[model samples]
Target chain A: MTTGSPGNNTPLIEARGLHTFYGDSHILHGIDITIHKSETVSLIGRNGMGKTTTLRTLIGLAPPRQGTIKVHGRDIKKSKVHKIVHQGIAYVPDDRGIFPNLSLYENLIMAARSGPNGRDDWPLSRVLDLFPRLKERMGHMGNQLSGGEQQMLTIGRALMTNPDLILLDEATEGLAPKLRKIIWAVIKQIKKAGIATVIVDKDIKTLLEISDRNIIIEKGKIIYDGDSEKLIKEPEILKKYVGV
Target chain B: MEFSFYLIQLLNGIQYGFLLFLVASGLTLVFGIMDVINLAHGSFYMIGAYLAFWLTGIFGSLFLGIVLAIPLAVALGFVVERLAIAYLYKKGHLHQVLLTYALILIFDEAQRFLWGNDSHGVDIPAALSGSITLTDIQVYPVYRLFVSFVCIVIGVGMFYVIQKTKLGMTIRAGASNRQMTQALGINIERLFTIVFSLGVGLAAFAGMIAAPIDSLYPGMGDNILIISLVVVVIGGIGSIKGAFVGAMIIGVSSIFGKTLFPSMASIVVYAMMAGILIWKPQGLFKSA
Candidate 1:
């Protein structure tokens, strides 16, 4: 386990003992996660292994039955989803929830707001510049966009909020190879811009390469949490837990 | 009928349609965005008329009464949304129906207790009391024309807000996915409250403005409620544009039916609704 390094005093998000449930079915079992500043963390697990639930819990979408979630040492377990997000966290859901009725410009502009302490680092122009394809299709409604374009719009919409940390669930789920390359490139740029990201994607190889740390979950519990280099050295652990 | 007679009926139909639009727009938006069936929505209209009557009596100026009545209506809407409609969001349509239906009864009783079970009339503001002669024998009240003009201005403003503004975009986003909207740092609870209140305010404003023409009476909201619901259904629930189109259709058909087929005038609007539903069951415009 990696403790806080010197000069990295406070983690961006610190979630402890998260036990979440969907209806009567228990999903997460005492899951603990920590996302440090400017660090890219990859969350890898097989389908329906509580991967999405963890992201949902941290963002307060699915408030855990028993857990404490804190952002910058401020307890947010009982806070509303929007209030938690106001703490400089943005969540891109697995379904890429774009407003189908709204135009692309409307979608991006609606989520536009300054980050915590009025930080306005990411403006509309900056976001559109990041995803040139979106700028080209500004007048089109969200439903008119292709799946790849929708994914880019979702990410661009998230960045419009100028969030400090982004929880990306299924960053590249259903996409062509060329689109996937574009999404991965954007992810790297987002990471380069110093936004801490907890990415959940099926591409284990690319995740292992791009992430600073890798945390593997199995049946709702953390099986491996360590350096990316160390996880790369242990191929047996990856094959056993994630089948990578 | 003479050509001038048909022209007068057409103008009246358009005027009535505009009034119905004011009521149905709120209903459709509430149903679309919040997914709540607010059966008591018409109660706001009733209260608006009653408020105009009571306030006009107090202030002695219909113009001042209307101006003051709007804020009161809006404030009442805000309170009702916060106290009653807010809780119905998570509940199913059955619960929403039952609760809102109960609210209708409560508002009815409250109206009777406060204003008494008597019909009252509000005089048109002196400025709008004059009539313009369309023909030597056919004269149209300026107030009715003013009502149409005001409704048009409000409608245009509403369109601009929904189509071009940030708040409008967020509302559409909320309708699309409430969870995702909240995740994006939007205070959806606040948004819902604003939308519900706006719906209430619009309905009440419709009632207040229509009070002079329709008069104030007990259970007046019930009739308008049913008609507005028909308008909403025809428009497609949750679509403002659809509501406007539906209201106009019903307005014109009902007016013409009254003139041409007096015996079956009541059924004309319903027949029109059925016919439209058969052709385009999803409504003229899909929900926004």
Candidate 2:
């Protein structure tokens, strides 16, 4: 499962006209977003704009009913969540999803699986290097961790999977300024490691600084798509779409 | 002499509790992981005892009978799970209860149809067919002690699997957050099948081991099924440790209840359940 090196002209993900639902309420309607290898993209939208739905649909959680999704040129619209995960897309859900009963070490180790290349890319040593606080609290249960610590553990666990791509939903919500800085720094390091990332967060300035591209969604539609710098230049687009 | 009588009864209660743990551990896991309220879990117990009787008669060795009965019980567990319990997973609790209750009736009728409506008995192995004198007037059966020791080994093994191993770690994770575990690339549905089957085997093995002391009677499963449910509810749902402690508590209380108040024996465990529920609705040791 050795993938070609990054920047091969082929997009890592290609979602086209994806329509998703939460029971009767239609969420994502024909939304399309493409991501390239090792590149960081951010989904920017107001609350309930289906930013999270796109990520979920990509990972086969709430799979799109009305469109097609391909991961690395392979059709995956109907794959099970575990199969989709095995295809090397690691998702960090908004809830952080730390198993409360597992210790911090267990939480981190349980997600340990080799990437497509079968390399121990993000081992425990690598994770501990990125976030030393996790090292200090290795023996503590997931429930014992603070909100910020839980968030870091979530990101760290995702890395432990050695995935080809990572999707983050509201990764920095409900965190203090200091912790938010750590998250941003981690994002930079993730990019430097040549791992593709799709992030959803509220801080427009940070997203603009860290991401190569920006996508704006509204009412389950990709209303705006462009480079990060271009997205911020159009304050009216942010005002009109995101209600800024 | 009177104190020895009470002491013997106390050990009997503990012995019974261990047997209940055998059945309840499996019941609690299946219910916890799949949320299927399988009322027919104890049918395995009944089948186990019957299998012991038949196999022992065929082989002329009770020990040989116990050995062969293990895999047979596991196969039956797999068959039941694959045939009926698998379908009720998505249904409401009421529907689940109705389906499993229907299964219990089917099992009971099937048992009578196959083995007749009379009680069957098994003999203890020659090695364990002796007794230990506890007092001048009292003696404890060696077979019961052997049963208790086997149960202790299984309980410790179950604990080690759940608490210390990678598979146990996954099970603990799956118990808490099924969706998140799926997202982590674990084949959770497959895990369900194995766990469900493992549970069935435990319940059946309990009956197989206790066959010598407890007669194989029609509707034996029904009474034990209800009691095992009580154990599950009293212990936290899906908790093995809780099941163990809950089994001991119910076992001792019922023994005393039967001796001190014969009329209330049937309902005494339920009375204790009500008190415990009021104190900690989630049971004493909920899986964190």
Candidate 3:
């Protein structure tokens, strides 16, 4: 029976001894972490290192075989993905899973959750203001948006949910350098707005710049978890775990 | 046929197309948002027609019967989703097909168990019972025109709900990616249950409207389910606009096909579906 304010001093999300699988194949093993409020955490690793799997486990898309996931200090491992979301955790997957038939405005509207501010924070106007290009492409379908625009829409969509913690997997994957910079800038803005975030991506240096802390995972286990600065100074440790 | 007769038939085709739109829209929404393939959807329509038949007989007012029948059908839809459909959500599509197929059988048996396997007639209300005179020999049924009008109204209403409203957005998101919609704090399970019920309700409403002209009998929904599936395949999975367009195409083609080449009517519809599949392989409206 986990209970507390989703905000405040309570950790937004905490996973203890999480285990997950794809059929008989085990993907995540005893993964543990806590995302504090207003913190930007990054999960860095090579492909198939269980980064996306961890994110998937949190959302109940691939529910963990064992362990507990507490949202705002409450155990939610048993809850469905939608139920867990009601407790306040937003996830953006690696595939940029936009509804191809729906317009940009429609996509954003779908993720809108009632926030503490009620009508005050992150209205359609504010979202459009943040991604001005989205406003211009408001009527365009999701499939019509450029890759950069799609990335922007995806981030905008997560924010629209007003989640206490936003999980982004492969945030900068398959993007040009310019789009990547814009996304990092957007992440910085999100940090300033005081929303906690977990970003998983391949670009270690850029992610290190945006994320307050980084966790390096190898073969489904957290090999290293520490402040980004520490990992940068000790590139040897990064290479040891990530081989970058 | 005379040129005017062809024009009148064209009007009939449009009218029929519009009705198909009403039914297929709900079908597509259920497929898209809930990600559940409900084989028993046609049963809802059959049930609605039966309800219309009974209620009109009891109340002696077609309008009153239709109005009363809708809520009853929608309530039944809710019950079916809660009792059976919810259990099948995490299961694969194969399981859904099997379970819902079983549901159709169950519903058919139950309907027979209660209503008997006999044909029944429902009368159009007095307000819409008469016909508008076209030519000396040509008269259009007022009820059919009313049916078309009702469909248009419902289509416009559904479009508004799905496009201009907040709930529509959530539904679209749910269809696009079910996992992410839930992660965004949407009560997606409740959303699914609601969507399923609504889909059933729409199918039922179509059945009610159709009862007056087509009459009610056992296995009435069997052909409709197949035809609606054809509409879904033509439109693409999870696209409302696509369903509407597909319904229109199927409706017009079927009407004209029966007139032009009686033996080839059903074949032509299937061929159109095959052609569309070959061209897009994802239907006319693609949802990622």
Candidate 4:
């Protein structure tokens, strides 16, 4: 839980003046963000607008060119991706890079590392409880699972890490509406459990419904940052930035 | 040939196949997990055999020599991984091939410098030197059966470790997705070092056990390395099960090929590899 109320000062993760580049091309430019405890924030933008790039940089996957990334008030600028993960930040990449040949149980067990926070948060049983679908298909290889099941497995794997904050890149990018709703429901449930979430997706309506704040990005910069209700009221801004 | 003769050859083939699995599993894991293509892995096997020969001669105890050879081989494996394989992690595949090739030369020369160029024979332990007669037409070496038993035990133990333990999960995950596994908080460098050494250890152990039956020659490593690669390619790149299955297929096929067409036996293995690759480009079980 945050020591101070929202808009006062305390935030679980804060990204200030973040800049990222892939080779010579600049991807993220001077992006600032503050995510409070137990809040679900959605990053909405069209393709190539640097939504995923920001998440990647924050997670230390693509090292930021210039930025201050603070998790639980600790600076993580020079930290490696695994170190960041050890600090209780879990990232589910867009590709859902599941261990394709490994059985679903193997994938979850492998990713489960006891952080400084301890092992009680996300044990195998807890993870199976979170995603019961994973329990049913525990012996199935990753590639053998359907798209929806893979997505669930990805989320379950992250949860097994006992992460305090979970980053979902394109949470429901290619899922059916029914699956999308299921993912959204799970996200809401995760938020209720006091785990901070930052989800990147194109489903603006669904994202807004679950998110405490919605940040609209254009050309790697936040054009609009405010409460989800305010974001919904501003249809013109949403249409300009997000196609939906 | 008679059915009994065929049966003996079949059993011999299985024996050979299991030995190959022990060597190839480590090679495949090193290749898959660390992405380090070590042409010198076979050199460890050679060193193991030589070490066993010398240690057994000195200690006058075959068990002591075999046990001592394991740690020495592992230490050598660690040195090789640190000195050569570590530097090649981010470099392209071509560099890996060249460096490991160079390593093979260095190891061979070093081996020759210490042990001379003559082929050396290891004495079979008295306890296992006997033979079992299956029929009037045939007899099987008790040592060969012992080798098969050792390989089978190692195989089963490895299977349990890989399937039941946390380390196995990490190994499989690293083999499957290197970057993702690292991102999940695994210190990939440590994992690489451990895996590379473990692989080297297995290859060395295989060599030590096999030395008494097969003479130790300078270029023996080269022959085994090629066969291991063939096993890896046929079984599937990173799949452990693939390595086991491929080794058996190659082992049995080679035995059968020799029986049918003596001169073309080696060619059959390569031909089988080519066919398998053509059918499955990613391999029999491509890791996700």
Best by lDDT: 1
> C-alpha displacement of B141 in model 3, angstroms?
1.7
Cα lDDT of model 1 overall?
Answer: 0.90
DockQ of each: 0.85, 0.76, 0.59, 0.58
Evaluate residue A195 in candidate 2 and report its C-alpha lDDT on the 0 to 100 scale.
85
Q: Measured with DockQ on alpha carbons, how good is candidate 4?
A: 0.58
User: What TM-score would you give candidate 3 relative to the actual structure?
Assistant: 0.92
Q: In every candidate, how many clashes are there?
A: 0, 0, 2, 0
**Which candidate model has the greater TM-score, 3 or 4?**
4
> Which ranking of candidates, highest TM-score first?
1, 2, 4, 3
Please provide, for model 2 over A1-244, each residue's C-alpha lDDT reduced to its tens digit, 9 standing for 90 to 100: 2343334686788889998998898999899889888889989999988988889899888988898887777888988898888777899999999999899999988889887647668889999999998999999999999999999999999998888789999989999999999999998988888888999999888898899999999888988889977877889998998777
Please write out the lDDT profile of model 3 over residues B1-117, one tens digit for every residue: 777688777878888788677777778888877788888888888988898888988899877898999889889988988999899888899999999999999989988998998
- By summed lDDT, the worst window of 10 consecutive residues in model 3 chain B runs over B177-186
Q: Rank the candidates by DockQ, best first.
A: 1, 2, 3, 4
lDDT tens digits by residue: candidate 3, A1-244: 1122345677888899989999998988899988898889999888888999998888778899899998877788888777776665677888878877678888888777665334235677877888888988988998899988999998898778666667898888899998888888888888888787899988888888888899887888888889988888999988877887
| lDDT accuracy of residue A171 in candidate 1 | 99
DockQ-wise, the better of 1 and 4 is: 1
Report the CA-based lDDT of candidate 4 relative to the real structure. Answer: 0.86
For each candidate in turn, the TM-score is 0.97, 0.96, 0.92, 0.93
Deviation (Å) of B248 in candidate 1:
1.1
Candidate 4 — which residues are off by over 4 angstroms? A1-11, B278-282
